[model samples]
Target chain A: MSLRLVRIDDRLIHGQVVAGWLRALGARRIVIVDDATARDEFLRDVLTLAAPSDVPVEVLNIADGAIRCIELAASPEPVFVLARSPRTVLGLRQAGVPIEVVDLGGMGSGPGRKRLHKTISISPDELAELRELERLGTRVEIQIVADDRPIPFRSLDSTH
Target chain B: MGFGQAALIALGYYLANSPWLFGLAYYTLFRPLVAGLLVGLILGHPAEGTLIGAAINVPYLGFISAGGSYPSDVAFAGWVGTTIALAGGLNPAAAIAVAIPLGLLGTLVFYGRMSVSAVFAHWADDRAEKADINGVAFMNVVPGQILLFVISFVPVFLLALNGPGFVKDAIDRLPLWFSDGLVIAGGILPAIGIALTMRFIFRGSAIPYFFIGFILFTFSGGSMSLVVIAAIGVALAYLHLTFTGGLAPKSTEAAAEIATAPVLMTSDETAPAGRHLTRGDVLRSWITWSFFSHANYNYERLQGTGFAHAMTPIIRKLYTTPDEIRAALKRHLVFFNTEPNFGNVIHGAVIALEEQRANGAPIDDDAINSVKSGLMGPISGIGDTLSQSTIAPILLALGIGIAGGTATGSSIPNFAPGSTGNVLGPIIYVALVSVIIVGIGYVAWMQGYLRGRAFVTDLLRSGTIDRVLTGAGVLGNLVLGALAAKVVTLYLAPTVSIYGAQLNIQASVLDPIFPGVLALGLVLITFWLLRRVSPLWILAGMLTFSIIAAFPFFGPGPQNPNDYSYQACTSSLLHKYAPCGVPPAPSAAPQASPSPAASTAP
Candidate 1:
């Protein structure tokens, strides 16, 4: 039950997953790491309802999610980890979970963010944390859906 | 027929390019129904134009152009389809049959343009790396327009000038069985669209909502307006959200509480925040991006070059050093795509972040890119569903129904084909859609800037979007149900005589239970088949079935214009309650001959 893929998508469980990503990843379990979604029963119900019936979905806060990810590291079953922000993925990685790759799926345009890609908008703080994660040997890639080729994380050649 | 009409057709094609240049929605300008009305007005036959447009548009109701993939060119179909239909003096149904083949051929132009656009994107990339902002903007706009003009103007000018005679000749030569197959095929094509929509909206819990819409419209005798259905749907969705406690703890309170919430494993780094961008700067970027996001769309980066082009104004404002500007430009020049209207908020937020980075925040390329990558998928998923799938369909159906009017009589004045009210249908649709898109886009962009990162988080937590989606789902399902009942035309022609009593299968069996039961069943079956079989296969099957069935009373040719109505047995095969092969005389109705004399002998 090792973490198969860690994805960052603010909308959480929606069509890109149920229709596009699930088939692409062929994963049977989804663990959503978000404090707000985990505590809110209504959100949890909605998320579960939104996902396909066959994919067992569980929503947990960062702490429990990290523990779950660590526990699943030993199992043969592949587990998909999802969170709303890069911070959560960083949190899971810092918690000693061996996440090999982090996939950034969606982040909406908001104030104080820049458009890096069509579906992604990020704040400076979020960007810093992602760079730190990349430096820590966790490869970060941005892909819109399952079918798309993942673009490797690239940074400005600051030496110039 | 004349230079002016040809010019108008060419103009419609040119306007279709506005999605890239003027930032006007692609849906508004190119949709066959809407384009038809515009073309009709130019030709001094708005009513005829609309009738033709509506007929041509029906087959493409479920059309989607996600990620710049043009499966069939609706714009080409609408402009050329209406032109050919009107010029050839063909009935709208027959015109639809004519237009489909043309639309498929238009895909060649689409791919040609897409392939050409990539060269420009590469040129823009070279300019961007050199920090030539003006050059990048020029590449985004100029070459694309030149290419657009050549593709749209040449074909339409020639087609409108010389092709009408050819169209008439071709249509005349087509066998009745084949022509009839086209009409039947057109009537049943909406099922494919409805099924595709069902695939998008279907979830286990949401299934019941679909039925509610279906049952309500079925029981209403097909008289209920979509507006009223939408209003009721909104209320039901609200209740569902509130009763389920989906919107709880209030988003503001949640945002405030969650700020202090503990992360068990992650280290927290507190970066000092400072104001950098003015509202004017952010708005400037939005305007630049909205109009030119896909101006230089290419196979290599999609919207990547446009992304860099949009950030030019902000990049200039913040970074004075050439290296800084170069870094900023390179950062944004990456692959990106999303539902443009609802997804612009991400742009707004990123502008704010860039401002902070200029003011000494530790933001680098990866952070900005990472955020964009994360949001693109989910926002696009939601945005595509909201804008393209749900809202557009509802608005179009309303417009089509209004323009079409009631089956038995004309409630609105006949401006041309049916009534002056038909014009109002498209008018109301364009206005309503324009207002909602602009209003929502402005709000999302501003909110992203004002609230910063917390804005999106708050939006999801507020449950407004979820509630709105649920409501829209309810409304969409009901409207589709109503549309299926009223628009999709499929019926049984067989009659059963038991105990000396003649009972019509459609009238006595299906009509009493619900209007359009056969149409609805066909739609559902198509939906099921869509899951298992490819769309191409289903389309082929529908064409085959329609043609084969033409051997009976339902033989392919022009169906009575009146036959496209919701009344089960009146218009189609049962010409006047007696099925087509059966003479009005009950004595002759018992004959074994199923073929109507009008059917072309196979």
Candidate 2:
């Protein structure tokens, strides 16, 4: 089974993903599970390029994502999973998927926001949602690029 | 409503109800580069996708998305940067350099609650389990990106990559007038996105200022620059906020007045519409002392940092429901360009929609965020295309040309943003951006109200785009008429002798039509004449005019204004070499050993 980091970062395949996560874990592939990115021939090519040449990229939105997931899990390839937002992460958690930790890397703040860090922001609901995730014991930590120690999302309010 | 819908509902339930996969999608799928490339491939050219990916990757190159409130336009930069770079033979470095401001234009596409994207993801997951093939495909496929990264990229990319030579050749061959018209047309086309955004954002108080700006500028004959006018706009916006707008009667502050709202007396709480806002409430929303910072204004679409601006007020309202609050928050969190008050109307409409939903109206966030997503992609495309790439460069080009003594320069060459009629270009640019921003605001706000939360989502759907395009086409045609009549300038004749029985046969044949009018007519006639001409005509018209008139008239011969006569500018350098004997010869200091005077004297 691959040691895959399925993460929700909304700014998908960014420097944090490629330079931060993939470089650290020695991940060899990135499998994207989002219908829009998968079936989109344009997005497929984009994700393929985003994956390091040494590693491979497989983009399959949910339905088709299953096949790749099943395949990668059977294979020994290391992988990273990515999406562009938090709810994508939430969706996976609800599927009862076995994941050891949830890494909150980066999602740039915009309108109606409260800054969580230099790179993260949350509406009150987002704060509450992460709090709920912590209750579920999902380790939610915010990091931009990997080197810096992650800030736990559980303590986001005061911590930020 | 068979398997697809059922599966979608299941996935929506599971994912909305789930957490892990939501994490998966956020991190993996919506990557800027991945999304860019995917968009390119879907559009048909992976290379174009990569190119766009790289362009978007440039400005945000050193960026770190620390807080969730990133006000950069990396995605949009990639999308429109790729669109422009791929559309023509623009230098990649130049394209990247130019795309920075354009990237910034995307800052307005706020996601009040990015989590809303996750809701749709869950919706998809549920439908997937139900074996709703079409639903799975659609929910998975559309993020308002079906057309951009999906269809257009490939064709444009192929054209850009392996085909500039063909395009160059095609331009070389197109009819002269037709090409100029497209150039003229292109110059004005970007205004649409601004127009729509602005319509929503411009409050009644802001209207007189728009006219003030217009008259002050036009009366200045396009001298009041955009920066100056924008300063005026900003000052006016602030002044209105401070003086006339502040200190409205706080009727709602009284508990009794608020209690008058038909409160849902049931177990928990939910307020009805008519009962929600009292006259005081109506007056209160518009009242504010500060212009931008205090949260009255949205900071607009291309500004990229107003989520906080809009959110502060709503969060403070406190009486708004969590769902309503969440929806309100989510509405502002959409990926949008920050063009300021003009773009804020989208914020207002979205908030209104959420308010409706909270009032037990039919709208919900899932549908709303989809609209936000849909707008982010295209508005980014249009915004960058208009506000940044097209507007900025075209203004710069026009300014430089106007400054460099060539009002005859094509509208498509360059761009910039500013405020002043001293250089009419920048003021025009600001006006155009202002107009577009307001127009977009109106579109977003009204659409939100009319279509409900599902507006963005419906936009993400495959077929609804025709409705938008049809509307744009109609508007585009109207704009074309405007361009033909007003924007395109046409006048540059080489010579006009007293009798005007010109030695130049071409001049004699064209005695009735002056150079300017001829160019303008040609522009109108070309667009009118050629069934559907594209952008190449710009090159052709420039080439023809540059050779036959501009070069022959202005280049070798000295160009002077009508009432002015030419005088040879004395050459400071040539004085040393001034032929044999000229009177005021050498300087008192020291002559170059043998000056023309000394040599002639000796």
Candidate 3:
């Protein structure tokens, strides 16, 4: 895909995306892959309204997201891919979508999750999936925003 | 008057740039509603200033600056609009008309300033490479603020000092019919603002809430205060959520439980943590974020430069080696953007992480970045809804109501322009906003610092935010409805004399049907237009309609200062419950007075 960056952020699009990352990356469009949000008409509308007027947004389920990514692989404009969890990205990779680098942006704190970065709180199950993706040769790195140098996921301690 | 107004304009300059010193909440002091009141105080007409500011603020209710792109400048419109209106003796409506154009023009300066600030950001980037900490800090605040000061101060200063005279002289020269028509236009124009806010607050199911407010005010004879209505709205919303159960999603309850599951220092519990940074350092960084978070906002790395600047004190305190210092600066200089006040928790969590990393914690730079990246969006969503959409509009509406009381059918005139009511509106608004926000913000920052990322996540995921938003929406609807009933005045004075019975059309026919019925209809019509047509079109159409409608032939003329002609014309339109308050002795010289202003209350 012509995806310049693939980020895992629960909040698929927000101030950091519109005001920070989009400008820093200079991406033309954002493709948010979250099944629940894609089906929710209300949420989809809210996301579009929240987005900056210039940049277009596409909300799609995993299957559609994979197809769109494949189509965008040859498109002229670079696309920024985002999902709420690592498993979603892993699914795309398993489905024959080429994702070399996955930027870990934000995974919110909750039960059964250990705090990794100030922004990332991950469950053991999710961590195993990410590790599996790393073993499969995806350069999964923890880079919250564009300015920071991406730290290799291998460097982080997987143990809770 | 000239010197005082010039000084107030200088204050406006300081208020606009004061984010670096006073914190971002101080930015509200520059908003038109509040600024107008301050200008009024300076010009010996605080009430008039507040009334004018509130009116001017209506058109800009939905104004937002997403990603440093602005549609208009509220500070310029509010300060200059209030000053010109009060000084020139124009009503609130005419002042809004004048202020809107000025606000649109102010956008040029905003864009110009954003472009110039990029130059300053580049200079900071150079200093970052050299590890010149002090130089980087200066690049962030000094040059950028100077540009902001000049742009904000000069136009407002010149306009406030000189524009009044021109406005007064121009109005004096205009034909009486045209000036009277302006007053009519001013009265009708507030509908546009009321309608605009409706568009923002209205959604599925929420639509009925608006009409409930309208019906309540109409049936109650429009005497209730906004606070009382708000209380009623809150109770009703709570009951609706409790009984209906379907309106608010059920997941919110489960989310709330998970959110408040208690503070877990999961990974940090095992890490060897010691006090490396002092309380003073943490507070310093917090203050810095408060002031300079958006100071160097640009197209690239939105708050990147400002974030680096905020971290300087902490970085200097922690790192001794040049490499460490340079790395820390570059690390912070990454992309950062969030809602300023509520978003301070992220800064707090970062400060705690920095302290641990400095004290031999295995935490690498990526951990810190992830924490910020993760928390920024969720925190920002809560912050934007709470601060911008809910708090601002609710408070502004209450302030406007206090200033502009419900006096449509009263014998006494609608609260005079510079009266006590008008002055109190802005003062109360400033007080409430500062106390509630500043108090909550301070506690949250400290909590985030001590508790780290877990605290903010818990806070964001808590269902309290959703419930609060729902309640606020209900309150906003009720208040908007109350405001329509109180402020958006429209009536027809056409009377029919059948068989010499001399029937009053509005009082006899319309009052029996509903009070504020025409105003409510006008607001709904404007709301429909606002949805389909551009605001500029609605504005132009209203101006044309009001002026044409104000012609003497269209209805009864106002109480003419020179003759008894208006009294004779309107005598048939007088209501049975009240005597026409026209003075028995008609004076020789003309004075300005409109008999029962049909389209506008003030």
* TM-score of each model, paired residue for residue: 0.74, 0.31, 0.73
Q: Is candidate 2 or candidate 3 better by lDDT?
A: 3
CAPRI tier of model 2:
incorrect
Q: Over the stretch B362-395, how does candidate 2's per-residue lDDT look in tens digits?
A: 6565655544443332233223323333233322
Please provide, for model 1 over A1-160, each residue's C-alpha lDDT reduced to its tens digit, 9 standing for 90 to 100: 3466888877676546655566456578888998876877534644553344356778899999888889887788777778989999999889988888888877755447665654566788888888888888888888866645677766421311
- Fnat for each predicted structure, in order: 0.12, 0.04, 0.12
Error of 3 at B354 (Å): 3.0
Q: What lDDT score is found at residue B320 in candidate 2? A: 42
Model 3 DockQ reads: 0.08
Estimate the lDDT of model 2.
0.37
The alpha-carbon lDDT assigned to residue B79 of candidate 3 equals: 80
Error of 2 at B216 (Å): 34
Task: Report i-RMS for every model.
Answer: 8.2, 18.3, 11.6
- Estimate, for each residue in A20-139, the C-alpha lDDT of model 3 and write its tens digit: 466556686888887877775434544544444346778889999998887886676777888989989888878767777888876654446766754566888888889888877788
How high a TM-score does candidate 3 get? 0.73
Worst 10 residues of 3 chain A by lDDT: A45-54
lDDT of 1 by residue, B1-602 (tens): 78977987887787776545346547677788788788778777777677677767766777766665566888888888888877766555556667777788777777777677767876777887788878777887788768877887888888888877787666568654455555566567667767766765655455677677766666776556656766676777677766766534223324555444332111123324433556687778788877887776654466777778778888888888878877887778766776777777677767767876777668777667755655554566557767777778777766765664343111110111222225666677788777777677778777766655556555655556666666676666666666665556664555678898878876678777665677778888998786666565677788778766544353343333222222123333522244444324322122211111111223
Question: Runs in model 2 with CA error above 4 Å?
Answer: A1-8, A11-82, A85-105, A108-117, A121-160, B1-273, B276-349, B357-386, B404-422, B457-602
lDDT of 3 by residue, B375-424 (tens): 56546755765676567767777777766633432222132232224567
